[model samples]
Target: MADGNGSEKEAVVVSNKQVVIKNYVSGFPKESDMEIITGSIKLKVESGSKAILVKNLYLSCDPYMRLLMRPQGWEEYSLLKSSQGLFKIEHTDVPLSYYTGILGMPGMTAYAGFYEVCSPKKGEYVFVSAASGAVGQLVGQFAKLFGCYVVGSAGSKEKVDLLKNKFGFDEAFNYKEEPDMNEALKRYFPQGIDIYFENVGGKMLDAVILNMRIHGRIAVCGMISQYNLDQPEGVHNLMSIVYKRVRMEGFAVFDYYPQYGKFLDLVLPNIREGKITYVEDIAEGLENGPAALIGLFSGRNVGKQVVVVARD
Candidate 1:
């Protein structure tokens, strides 16, 4: 390490271009749809405004950002409609990347989507999709910590290995090579699923639906495998939800922003003491950002897909 001369760098805020969604996407967003065009940024925060001016050191590449790609979201809710200040920045002691995973949208999603939505009980049976990915990995670990029997499904064998060995998941399998998804799910979730953390929708969801236990709960975090498709796949096991008395729900992390502090308070200590661990698949430079963002659909990213913008 080298010592500095104790000089502060001048803040500049002439123009900033961000990756913004051009329009509502039907399915599978292309790189061309998002462009880095010129936008304004204030160098200093205004007084009386709790807003913060962040340099965006690192950006999280999350699946839900795809939903935000659509113009109409919770930000446009009739009762919650906002004419101004939709996207704002704030400061935190943790790395900016945390906002993408742990402290960010995905973390809160895993927290609220699991505990609040799934309403997991101790030692219950749990299954997660995209288990080694950002949200699934954390969800599996969370289930284990809650004394639940957890199994996860990933797209690759390496991710499966990491889920079972590295993340301490009870069991994990690669969905890609699995001949029959339903049979695979039945083999792993032999006792039926008490809680299903839905990640990749379509056929995988159909299988989980067929194997759900009575009074099961399903938390719809995302459908990565279905994001890129022009037409979303329909689940054939819809009757199971009614027969099994399953409760399925969809949620967004933005609605739970108020609970973020409460969330960090719960997860931070675990992180510091090594009780919880997070994995990231970081891509350097902004040029490769497009590919990294698209990789989520393909299940190419081993963990959380993060893009490094700048480091200060």
Candidate 2:
């Protein structure tokens, strides 16, 4: 640890760039609400400390992050107290960015929500909202692989096409073009949906509830439509759950992290054998983080939105 002069070398310092909130957000978020600043930090973690310092390669932009922009929400940085909650990347043959989408939290959310929460049966009629997104796309693919008739609803014609053509959903529709969601559901699923992967809530949930078959299962994964609103729109068909004997349940991915290994075992093989496919919208550099993160609420980015800070 000494130079030619026998003096100890100083710890290497680097300029660390970060995206920080300029102020707590209200309503829809904008790029101006966040600021990118550079700060210096030593490369080494302190001795006797349990902290781990990591260089971020990819950062995920998800719908849930909109809530973290509020004053009461929680946020975490690259430095960690320990590796307790971290999952090491075991398979690197696939794109490392997969860790941000298909091999990461979104993948887990789709797996746990569909297989565990929905308890799907083969040949069942399944529907997914926000169908082309990170989680919804996987849910659709999983249903197809499991012998279910999967239908997905996306916001745009392009996304709807991606859902049907790229991801192999049985059917996909642009929800924006559908005037009556109830009728739309009836068209895609004449027999009524046996399983619904609830991503877009409010009106869509109301329609899905009305169209659900007896003893249907609804896995409430997320409600992207309600995130930016001051007052979330209410679903009027709560009583339908009673009459139809539907099992409606909400889940968080954090609760299923314990089964991460099990999830990888199931998905990795499918990924390798071409039984599954994934899509991502990648925004490069830390400077563009704000815009990339803000893009989620507006459905501006297709597929899984990822921010690449560095490659190495």
Highest TM-score, which number? 2
| Predicted structure 2, TM vs. truth | 0.94
**Model 1 lDDT per residue over 122-226, tens place:** 989999998998898899989999999999989888999999988899999888889898899889988899999998899989999999999999999888777
Kindly report which residue stretches of model 1 are placed more than 4 angstroms away from their true locations once superposed: 1-27, 35-53, 70-94
Residue 176 error, candidate 1, Å:
0.5
Model 2, runs deviating above 4 Å? 1-9, 70-77
What is each predicted model's overall lDDT from 0 to 1?
A: 0.79, 0.88
Q: What is the TM-score of each candidate against the true structure?
A: 0.82, 0.94
